[model samples]
Target: MKLAIMQPYFFPYIGYFQLIHAVDRFIVYDNIKYTKKGWINRNRMLRDGKDVIFTLPLKAAPDSLDICERSLSADFDRNKLLNQLHGAYRRAPFFSDAFPVLEQAIRFPNDNLFSFVFNSITGICDYLDIKTEFTISSEMAIDHNLKGQAKVLALCEKASADVYVNAIGGIELYPRDAFAARDIELKFVKSKPVEYVQFGAEFVPWLSIADVIMFNSANEIQENMLGEYELV
Candidate 1:
């Protein structure tokens, strides 16, 4: 089966979805170290023609260690953030239909970044009608190496995966000969730009579906997804 592994990200970029569309099973590496400044708890969105970042705040503690094990800040007030998002996207064309879904997801009572991100993943899958099974590496019998080829090979063994597909970003980090030695074929995925009409006369690229949904109808959004990305 085709397997792809990635860290759980909060409303990740389009490349993240491309990986999901390419694989049979997706393994989220939530058991790994938590990155303090990555997309684990934030993502970019378009706001009034400018790029804005939305984040889920985490409470810091003296002993905060693992990213996978870390929880959202205890002081996080869900309703307040929901209000902010609503105000930010209220005028979006698809807001009426998309807001409730996003609001309900953001209201989930969880403290971990993984829980938040996983909820977003499920929401997006539901929105886009994707049906791929997702697994957590920590819950699986995966190997424990975290460096370079060994890490990739270990994850493959854990999933019993024959063909391993990953984001194109890992091309330099992994050596092809190493995966070949272990009888596993490796391939990379790249996301092509999808264009859609927003509120203006011009088409925009790389804006999140949230941006499109707020400014366009679901039918138009679905129609815009006609473009396809590639598995390199």
Candidate 2:
């Protein structure tokens, strides 16, 4: 089986989904520590033809907490977030179709950071018709104490995966020789250039999947963006 694992992220860029599409069992890491600098609770979105970062408000807590342990701030205003998205993409052609999906995801009634993000991701995947199976790392039988590439290898072994797919950026983190020693193939997904009309404005690349969904239909995304990458 092909496998890939990554920390949960908010509606991330198209490359994130490309990683999901490349694997059979995609594991989402929730037992991992929450990093303030990471893209766990934040992602970029298109605003006025420029990329802007939107963050999910998390309650003030020690940075060492696991992602599942983090709580959404009490003051998280779902409407405000929805309004921000609506205002930004109101004029886009696919907004009518995409808004419902985005609204359902944002309005998911969860206060835990990981749960909220997971709901959004799965919902978006359903909308895009990507049927890859998902697994939560915390619930797996593997040793949870392992770190870095060791943790990944443990998960791979536990899942009996013959090939492990990862984002291109992970090439440095996971050496091919290491996986080869274990009789597993390691491949990196390099996303090709993804360009689509953004209401005639200068195209801003790598915005959130929210931006992509707003402008492109599920069919367009599935046909072009879903397979628009190379495994190297």
Candidate 3:
């Protein structure tokens, strides 16, 4: 089986989804440390013909805690976020069909940060018709204490993965020789240029998968956007 692993992200970019779609199984990391200013709870969206960031507010907590250990802020206004999305994409072409998915993800009642983001991811994958199986890293029997490539190798071994794929951003972080030694092939996914109308402006790239959905039909996304990637 081909496997890929990544931290749960809130409405991450298309490349992230491409990585998931490129693999047979995807492992979402809930056991890792929560990142203070990363995509764990935030993502970019296209607003006013420019890129803007929208975030899920989290309660105060130590940065060292795992993502599964964190919780959403008690006072997080789901309506406010929905309103913000509506304000931004209300004019989008496919708003009627796509808005509901975003609403469901934002209004998800779960307080755990990982659950919230995982809901967002799975919801979109369903809409896109991605059939890849999912695994939670913490649920695996591998030693969670290992870090870096050691941890990855352990997870791959546990999954009986024949090949491991990753996002292009990590090309420098993983050394191919090590995987070769383990009889596992390592490859990187790079999204080819995917452009579509956004109010007919010049065009903004990598806003969010949410942005992509707002402007394209499910058929368009599944047939064009999802497969618009190459394994490098």
Task: Give me the overall lDDT of model 3.
Answer: 0.92
Q: Where's the lowest-lDDT run of ten residues in candidate 3? A: 221-230
Q: For candidate 3, report its TM-score.
A: 0.98
lDDT (10s digit) by residue, model 2, range 1-232: 9999999899989999999999999999999999987899999888887888888999999988999999999999999999999999999999999999989988898899999999999999999999999999998998899999999999999999999999999988888999999999999999999999998989999989999999898999999899999999
User: Local error of candidate 1 at 13, Å?
Assistant: 1.6
lDDT of 3 at 31: 98
lDDT of model 2 at position 231 = 95
Query: CA lDDT of each candidate?
Result: 0.74, 0.94, 0.92
Q: Which stretches of candidate 3 lie over 4 Å from their true place?
A: none
What TM-score would candidate 1 get against the native? 0.88
The residue pairs in collision within model 1 are: 34-67, 58-73, 59-73, 72-111, 92-214, 93-214, 93-215
Off by over 4 Å in 1: 62-64, 145-148, 201-209, 212-227
Q: Clash number for model 1? A: 7
Write model 3 residue lDDT over 1-232, tens digit each, in one string.
Answer: 8999999999999899999999999999999999878899998998888899888889999878999999999989999998989999999999999999998998888999999999999999999999999999999998899998899999999999989999988899999999989999999998899899999998999888989999999999888888888888
Between candidates 1 and 2, the one scoring higher on TM-score is: 2
Q: Give each model's clash number.
A: 7, 0, 0
In model 1, the worst 10-residue window by lDDT is 218-227
Off by over 4 Å in 2: none
Order of candidate numbers by lDDT, starting with the best? 2, 3, 1
